[model samples]
Target: MTDPTYEFSRAITRRPAASITDGLRAEDIGTPDLGRMLASHAHYVETLKKTGAEVIELAPLESYPDAVFVEDTTLCLPQGAVMMRPGAPSRMGEVAEMEPTIRGVYDEVRQIAGPGHIEGGDILVTGREILVGRSDRTDAAGVTELTEIVSDWGHTVREVFTPPGVLHFKTDCSLLDGETILSTKRLDASGCFEGYRVLHVAEGEEAAANSIRFNQFVLAPAGFPRTTEMLRQNGYDVVEIDNVECAKLDGGMSCLSLRF
Candidate 1:
């Protein structure tokens, strides 16, 4: 069966703002080098293109320091594009800035109202259902609102509690195919993916769980040799790229683009 999660032909990404150091971070992991970040981002865009995805690169929004994490701004589904309400108040405006671009591509654009903050990172869409994590960044209200919106589109929404210390649900898991999941050992222990085939990220490389299985290739974060080898062994055509700079800001390969 075809995996709905990896059936993306178009993708949207934003350039990292020059003031990225001012962006939000869960931990003070040293400032990222802007020059290296830019180079890495360029390589990321090229990788997406090489995978046959039509990449839409948006200019940097200098005012929004964390604008580079574009995946948090919206969720692009086959039905339409939903403008998300970021959990972080500082990152909220990034949604409005992204609205126009999203509207230009998708005819059915939806928005999540306040009293409910839903970031895309907390959502994972599989072929049969959509999983929304109940995390600090995504609350019950948000999941409720999201459920109401997508249920009409023929999708069942499953709510999962994000484990403590995980920034987003995807921070510990990713959909590799319709029935397979690439996840951290911590999340797998939660039993959220009990029915799916769970492929654990290599020990000490927990960050590798946040990968993107786009079309025919898996865009994995570079430097996680063990995890990369594991994916390859599983028969995936993996393409690893450096995302260390973005990782400093709690980003991963999946965070760089909103694909649909």
Candidate 2:
């Protein structure tokens, strides 16, 4: 059975603004750069189609560029969509805005509530367990809530501590398939995933190693030549997109959009 939490007919993302970083001059966020970003995103849209996934492109709302899409944070279990409360204050509004669209996509949708934050970027699923990262964005309370919420669906939840430096769980880990996983020493593997199988990428691929799986939509940044090849070698075709604009502020394929 397809894991009820994973699906890939359609995905969603917020349109970015001319500049992602604050205080940066318009020249720094020039038209050419923005154009490159858009073209790259368009490539991503096409790549999703290659995996038989459809795109649900959302028009920008007042053009707030910092909103890390809550769409991904809201995971779809067999029960419903659990809308995560984002840890970032500037991004809290995004969850509210995305609920209506999500409801249209799934009949039953739920919320992850405030004071307990969870960001989609920090969660990864294997065939059996939902690995959650307890980080600056997704706090202790947030993981607890997730554990309880998903337990009802018969899915086990496990916690991985985010090294103080990394911002998200996925920044250091990604799933290649049901049993294989690509992660980094930065994650302190033996400490978190005691008995699971893991492949540790070299230092260079740490950031690029974090990719999101949407059906066959394997989302990763434009770089990662070696890591991409490794994935391809493992029988998974890969899609690389330019997230230069989004990357400036720690965004990537997974952060920019939510797939369902």
lDDT per residue (tens digit) for residues 90-110 in model 1: 999999999999999999998
Backbone clashes, candidate 2 = 0
Kindly list the per-residue Cα lDDT of model 2 for residues 1-260, writing each as its tens digit.
66433456777766655544441221344323566767777777777777676777777655445653434457765556788887877677777778888898888786786568898878877777888888878988988988888887788998878887777887787776676677788685547756667766666877776676767656777677887877777677677877666665655666766766
Candidate 1: stretches off by over 4 Å? none
Clashing pairs in 1: none
The lDDT values for all models are 0.90, 0.70
Compute each candidate's TM-score over C-alphas: 0.98, 0.86
Q: Looking at candidate 1, what is the lDDT of residue 161?
A: 84
Runs in model 2 deviating more than 4 A are 3-7, 23-32, 68-73, 188-190
Please give the clash total of every predicted structure, in order: 0, 0
